[model samples]
Target: MIVRIMGEGQVELDDAHLAELNTLDDELLTAVESGDEEGFRRTLGALLDGVRRLGRPLPDATLEPSGLILPAADATLDEVRKMLHDDGLIPG
Candidate 1:
């Protein structure tokens, strides 16, 4: 799988790594939904450690701007369309 970070470069992950990442994401989300703080923390920590060992930076931990200027949500549809087309993303 090719994982692309907005500001950072993309990563190519093999099947095994992708599966582990999916399992970790599922476990973390399950823990959150069940209100299991300890489980969530443990699972998150393990996920971080595992990804760190893979030598790639962790995903964005916050929603801060990536220094790339993006169109505002209220922009006209045509404007948004142009931006998406320029960015190689298409509305589905």
Candidate 2:
């Protein structure tokens, strides 16, 4: 799957990474649900770091649509919560 992080370019992630990503996503959701700002920040950072670490960066010339879109690294909890209810930002 190709995921686009806003403010950054695209990264190609494979099926092998999905399970771990899902776990991170769950942690993020839990943080959001509980309104835990610290947890949200920590988990969100970890999630983005995982993507950067595990995903292959697509070249600048690549223009394929992203299969999933994640918020920017600087995204706030309220911003992400808005994204969750209104958009299919994460794919299971």
Candidate 3:
């Protein structure tokens, strides 16, 4: 899967990481819904870190369509809230 971290470019994540990503996405959704700024930041970092750790970074010029688009590391809670969908930022 091609996962894009906005402002950071994209990474090619394996399908095996989908389940783990979904778990983190769920946690992030919970934090966002509860208005827990700390949890939101924590989970968001975890999610992005997971992608960076588990996936290979695509070259900057590789402009493939993103399967999952995550907010930037410095994104505000309100900013991330707008990016969420019914299935959260990551789809199962």
Give candidates' CA RMSD values in order: 12.6, 2.0, 0.7
The best candidate in terms of TM-score: 3
| Residues 23-77, model 3: lDDT tens digits | 9999999999999999999999999999999999999989999988889999999
The per-model lDDT (C-alpha) reads: 0.46, 0.86, 0.94
**Lowest-scoring 10 consecutive residues by lDDT in candidate 1?**
83-92
TM-score of candidate 3 to 2 decimals: 0.96
Reference-based TM-score of each model:
0.45, 0.90, 0.96
Distance from true location, Cα of 12 in model 2, Å: 0.5
* Model 3 per-residue lDDT at 80: 95
List ranges where model 2 is wrong by over 4 Å: 85-89
Colliding pairs, model 2: none
RMSD of 3: 0.7
Best by lDDT: 3
lDDT measured at residue 54 in model 3 versus the true structure, 0 to 100: 97
Question: Which prediction has more favorable TM-score, 1 or 3?
Answer: 3
Which segments of candidate 1 are over 4 A away from where they belong? Answer: 1-16, 57-92
lDDT score, residue 64, model 3?
A: 99
How would you order the candidates by lDDT, starting with the best?
A: 3, 2, 1
